[model samples]
Target: MKYLLLSIFLCTLLACTPGSATKYPYTIRDFPDSLRTDLRKIVNYGFIGSPSYESAGNIRMQISDNDCKRLALSEHPILRSLALDILCNRHHLDHYSIMMQHLDDTAYVNWYYQCASFTFITVSDFMVKEYKWYTEEEKNRTVEKIIRDHNYLQSAYEALHKTTLTEAHYPFVRKMAEKETLMKFRSEALLHLAGYKKISDTGFLHNALYQSRHELDANAFGIMELYQDPFYFAMLKKYFPGGYYRNFCKKDFERNTTENALSYVSALASYRSEESAAILEKILFQDPLVPCFPADTFRLRQHLYEVIEKNTCEHYSKMLRVVKPWLERERKESAENGFPIDTTSFYQFPSDSTNPPKIRW
Candidate 1:
């Protein structure tokens, strides 16, 4: 009986080995020699020395520093590059967040205020599709949080600025305003004073600050939709001066007016109005690149095609006339380059697998 059991166990072990039909398939390609060697060193130093290294510093610092040292001694170019990026990011976590946030904020303001309503709609659609990782509840909560924080910051700034405006606490306000650390405080105060009758009115003004606040809120929503997080915008504001936001918007307006006009054309195409379609053709004739931003251009054209498909033959004709040349050029380029052009659409809806599907005419 013991011999029979031992033989059964041996057979079971052999049955589970790779290439056996009973074994699940997995890919286990060998790592590059340099990467394999460095990986081994990292494991050895990280795990084996961890107990002794506990006295060193934070876990992040110790691991990154040790890994970097090992990478420096490594001869593999790719591994060295990867290690350097990891070390740099680990070392400058806050700085990277700040820079990315500023860029995002700047982009948000420009897209929100200057772009056509259709552009906003298309971009919003793109953002939602691009960041479908976040659950609906998560997205809603994040947006609400951002709005609440923005309101709080705006209120605080208004209180400080009101004292300055009345000259009651002018010197203190001036001093606080001069410090770079308190710039958001100062700007919010100034904005509050400029927009509101008094400190008591700050809440009311924020609640009803129709165009500017709404535009800002929309931009924030756009960012949240794209990134699935609100922390990025705060980080952006932390690094770049708030003054840059206004300046960036102004520059985008001046440089992108023609582009914006083209967006209007794309919007007309989507709406399938004969008047707008005629205007689009004129614009397309003048400048082949209408909506300059690649993402915007792709989205605009897509919406235009969708409108054509669902609405009328006129829209279909208009789209073909306007887009055929571009599509043909793209196809030729894709063929030459051996890469497929991506033209995909995404629609978002609640997932309830247990519920029956509903049909609509």
Candidate 2:
């Protein structure tokens, strides 16, 4: 009789915990039938659609303050996050205490905001819901919390990166970029610094790039590309040796070697130097050392052409003249070969009804 009583007591305690199966149902059918219909709809289908903001906003409006508070008790992280959004955005209630309790809720939620859907942890969803209204001190504390907890770093940064950050936040961001062991977070921090254009240190970008390895290289190159500093011209040039961007000629398509080279190509193209132009001209015209399929070459050339067209310099005048005829020839060949012919110009130049403009380059 005592054993039976003790077993029931233990089961009751487990059922009441935050992540218990009874508290947080694994299936929709397991959720209590008594839940309000509107709240259930938000929890079940809120993450759908490409840009889900309109639908989500409408659903958020139907939740009452009382109903929204009840949602905070749900073990479903998405529903809990929805509750947080309602409390702050609709009712203008203080939900910081509730948010603190959910800081460790690492369950992923795909939230719709600003005409785009982003997948992030439940804590970040609510933090983002309330971030815009936070005072400076509150914002600082939020950043500190993100720094102290790795779980919040990526998702919180995604939601907060565009918010108005002043000079005071630079050091905190820089530390994460340089010192954080997680490359994804470090890369995000590096891009944040570049995006804000607030870094005071001259050597920071160079050092960051120098230290980057493997997947981090793409982001480091992206930072340099965004910075647009002529000082990195020599470093950019090193990537374009042997008439093509590094790794562009690799035979292994599975490794995506050529695709990965696009970042380096784009970084180099941002420079207007004669050396840069000459290298790119070779890339545009020369046959590869290791031949790719004709289709692959055409696609690669088209991508290269788009980058070149966008960043054309006086040095590219000769190359541009040669390119027009080559592209016209390719278009004719594609038509004869029964491939679908694109009506747009090879470089996607805007067409005029009569007499197209000469030399946009």
Candidate 3:
């Protein structure tokens, strides 16, 4: 018993040693103590309501220029991202040069937004697109290089968006749209071309949609929304059929499911046909209502009403028939729950029915 206790004591002591079982297990031996402290905070960042949650400013303040440069080279993608962010915050002339060092880093970083996060964005492609450090001339030259090399095509694709694309860029963008394996990159290229009204032939669009059978991503959906093609109405209906809608409205189907469902709804609203209206009517008025939280329910309704109101389809009035009574029921429910619904700012309900109330809060 005495020997066993001693062995257990030694194990715990070894476990508690400085480098052993560290929260950041990756070796950060090169950074100085103060910088290491800051890096530690950065390494553990993005947890909701945790002390590790760091804003950009807070991160920038602690990391020196020297420290940031070193951090930019970190094998750890998150730390490397921190270095890029700090450099971006500096707004220095040389920030772009330092950023170019890791422009090819395909290391995936999980980016957090409130409680939700996208797990797929690489450290290289995302943040650089957002910064405004490049000149119009510089942007053009860099985009040309990115396209010519094909090594940095993802960054090139993103840079294309910020610059005023010329005739020179269209072929490259279209080619990237054709060849890139990533759905987002392909869709993004298509979306960019569509934005410029350059997609006279939608063969590329159709092929891309066919490949994206798993889930029509946001950029692909953006194209459908832009063209408002009658053909995609049938496709959208097929993609978001009755079973999908039933699964989507449940409380458990929060997060990205909500966004995906809403995208389909918006696409449906784009069409002016009775078929489009019927799908929406079923969504808003049919059984198994959006059983998300009250706030989430409000959000879905707000989006539905705004889109329905803007649409000029013949079924608009038919679709809105339940609006007044629904609003009244919501008001009654709110009052009963001690959070009364205020004046409605969302839908201007048809005045034909005894002065319909608006919903704001």
Candidate 4:
């Protein structure tokens, strides 16, 4: 027992000795000093929530009325001098030094947050416009890219998993798998591409892999599908494969629905068929509680009433007026088909504890 203890002690001491384990064969520290310096600058200046540490005066002064013209003339000595002065004065060497040590750490965080927020705002606006800016070529390119990226991820994972022996390799392999899955799942670019194509070709809009209205961009196709067509809704279900619809249905009703409905109503007004009018009436008189209830259903109804009164076709005008009273009655009684009366069921409204007024006569 004494001999065994001595052997254990010797082994522990050896393990703790300096340079006992072999160092990695490669080191990133070998990168050139100039490259390292630039990298460091990126890290320091890009950290999230890190103080800009730049002088407010410098930031303000950088934005001149003629800055656009100066930028266009990229080789201008004056512009270059101004830029250098700003960099040197606003961020001291100490700040640059700190940034170099953690270059990617700060840069990646800042880029990720900026991209994420911008994507959210862009998507929301795009959806509101039914993806007006998206073109066919762009959609196809996005789809192809997603396919390529996904295949590359798969190949990398398979290669690593087959060759690695150390247990430490498992974490990396697992991470690759997760990344691939997430790309397949929440790849907004790919999903939007598919959605844009589907809507343009089939009159049906589909949801993206992820809903980014709050973070990246809201799926315009998804919004249209929710309000306009059952076909697009089915596409959303097929792609998402879970309770995605239920979650989507819970968004602010009047805001999303009213916008979509208005767009649809305006586009269909020229058709003037009974079917179209009936569809308009149905939308205009939906139960205020439905997920897609218009924000201004009352106003929409009043407008429709005026349109009907002014129509040149006597029969069409008569039919519209006839339908208007029934719709109004249904709205008052909370009895519109497919539309519920309680808008507050899908979203909370700001109000005191007092009971809401009843719509009944």
Candidate 5:
């Protein structure tokens, strides 16, 4: 009961400007009673299609240290999430103390992720809802600006990475980095911040590559990519035998257009290590998984090989011993019979999955 009341008070309290008694635009009550009822319904359903995104006016109320502490203690996921966003927004050195504690809580993992999921759905989702008020013409007409303005997910990450994590928070971030699951972008954002501040735990990162549990498909890989610290040659094998490649590649690779595969290759080539060359060579000879189109992949292999050849000459000798004969044979075969037309356009491959699926369409 206390938890419920606290939740209600906090939810309501979120509307107020922090450190000031003044409510800048208007309280939820300022809306017409009918509109307010409709707004509550939209909030309840967990969608943000209603006029509320605009109506809310990007209200970011401050969370006082007392309230920040209270929020950290709440068992409720929603409040826990709110606490995270508030701390990120506050950017004070003091908030680090509580955030570090949450980072260590095993149960708090999902709660932090849920909070990270965005305290609000982005305009991208809103455009899909196509509220009559927002989308009379095609959303394409104005969505670019709208999206840039309303990306809460980006805001959450920026707020987090931009804040300084003092020695108080360093131990905690390191602890979370050791085993935190499925927190890709923000995890890297924080990791990069840690790197900037020199709060490193390279040993933990090296060990984490071998552990497989994940929250999202890209979590571990993304952070590993971010560190490029004491760069691991084993990240090359993740392209082949790494736990992430097997588990998430099947489910998520088709979506990444095998850039996930390329990611491993890119990181591997970056190391220029013998092990990196060997792993790429091992995978190079193998057939691709079901979702992978062989024709496109043939080019991808060519691209990766070139990367390795350029980056690591010492190891390239072994690769050349085998690859030179294979390329000659392929050329001979092409001359004997016309080359199989390249169905996969290397030009068409996405550099990254930055263009998220369209919500407005």
Candidate 6:
């Protein structure tokens, strides 16, 4: 019994040692002391009435229940950054060092933006203000930091995926939309600005949206459907008329460089215009870029069809018009492969998923 107790004592001692931290996921023990300290501060999420909870400055924020989950449990590296992203956003704590640095690996940046907490921060920053947290000094400093990140351009852009611009940020997005050196980045800024529904300078937007000389600028083309400006239609008529929507750089999608074209498709579905239906139809037949999409071609087309159906009153004509061209293209393409599709079993959206009759693949 005495020997067994000694063995247990030794085991506990070893586990508590600094070297043991590596045994935890994410090699947490190796993390810098300061980083760990910051994590500790956040993981210690204050209770509802506890002193750990930060009171408001000019505003009080009732952060969502989902957002209130404390991050103290997980020791993963990405989760640590996410915890920081959430807790800092909730408390209005400043200094987003890890995610802002361009030198950081793709895993950290991708996860930081991909996580739910970051989305909340982006959407909530503006949303909660309608009801808001943080000291005046802290809020000002945080806003200043955001401006600094914005000035950093690409770095800021990556981080912005995990954050959103508030009313004050509308001006920043507006200026960037017009003055940014790169047309693609300018288009991105334009999209961000448009989300606020406040861009009034049609002349500037038209010039930026159509002035691009590239064979395909996803960022610029990406925003055309949202604004749906007559100028965009004029530009589309000259460049792509009668449902010709195939200029997304497939290479960019493979490179994981940017959101690229699949994002363009997601945005396209929201557009109800006849032009949009034509474009969606072209891709529905076959998008070689399906690997980059959130879903397979079949599923994507199904969703697009549903969206178009919802948007247009002339659903049957629009569906037939779009499908006719796609079917013809498919027949030619399938003939080349010597394996033509059976048109008898065409794809359609199941308006009622619960119906057992519609469950066929």
Task: Give each model a TM-score.
Answer: 0.25, 0.48, 0.57, 0.27, 0.43, 0.40
Candidate 4 structure quality by residue, lDDT tens digits, 15-55: 88644123212121333343334323433454321233232
Report clash pairs, candidate 3: 344-358, 344-359, 344-360, 345-359
Every candidate's lDDT: 0.36, 0.60, 0.64, 0.35, 0.45, 0.45
Please provide, for model 3 over 1-361, each residue's C-alpha lDDT reduced to its tens digit, 9 standing for 90 to 100: 9999999999999877755234334456777775666566656673212244554445567767876776677757777676676686575447657655556667677666454544456676655554554355555555666665543446766656656777777787777777747775667777777766744657667767766756566676677788867566657777766434543544554432556566667777888777778778877874545643323556677667767766756776786665656656777887888955576756774565443332110
Task: Give the poorly placed runs of model 5, Cα more than 4 Å off.
Answer: 1-37, 40-45, 50-181, 190-194, 197-200, 207-231, 234-239, 242-249, 252-257, 288-299, 318-361
| lDDT for residue 216 in candidate 5, whole number 0-100 | 26
**Candidate 2 Cα misplacement greater than 4 A, ranges:** 1-100, 105-152, 160-164, 182-184, 196-199, 213-218, 241-260, 288-299, 325-361
Query: Model 5, 1-361: lDDT tens per residue?
Result: 9999999899889766463333122333544453444334434444322233342223224334555455434443333344454554454444423333343222222111132343343322222222222223433433332223332333233333434445554544454454443455445434544464463455555555554333323435555555565544444453456542443344443343444555556666666667667776676666563234333566666666666655657776777676666666777888999866777755775555654343322
Off by over 4 Å in 4: 1-117, 120-257, 289-294, 306-312, 318-361
Cα deviation in Å at residue 10, candidate 4?
47
- lDDT for model 5, on a 0 to 1 scale? 0.45
Instruction: Give the Cα-based TM-score of candidate 2 against the true structure.
Output: 0.48
Q: Which candidate should be chosen as best, given lDDT against the real structure?
A: 3
lDDT score for residue 278 of model 5: 74
RMSD of each: 24.6, 12.3, 14.0, 20.1, 14.0, 18.5
TM-score, cand. 1 vs. native: 0.25
The 10-residue segment with the lowest total lDDT in model 6: 102-111
Q: Which TM-score value belongs to model 6?
A: 0.40
Flag clash pairs in model 2: none
62: Cα error in model 6, Å: 45
Cα lDDT tens digits, model 1, 121-159, are 121122222232123444443333322333232222333
Question: Model 1 shows how many backbone clashes?
Answer: 2
How many clashing pairs in candidate 2? 0
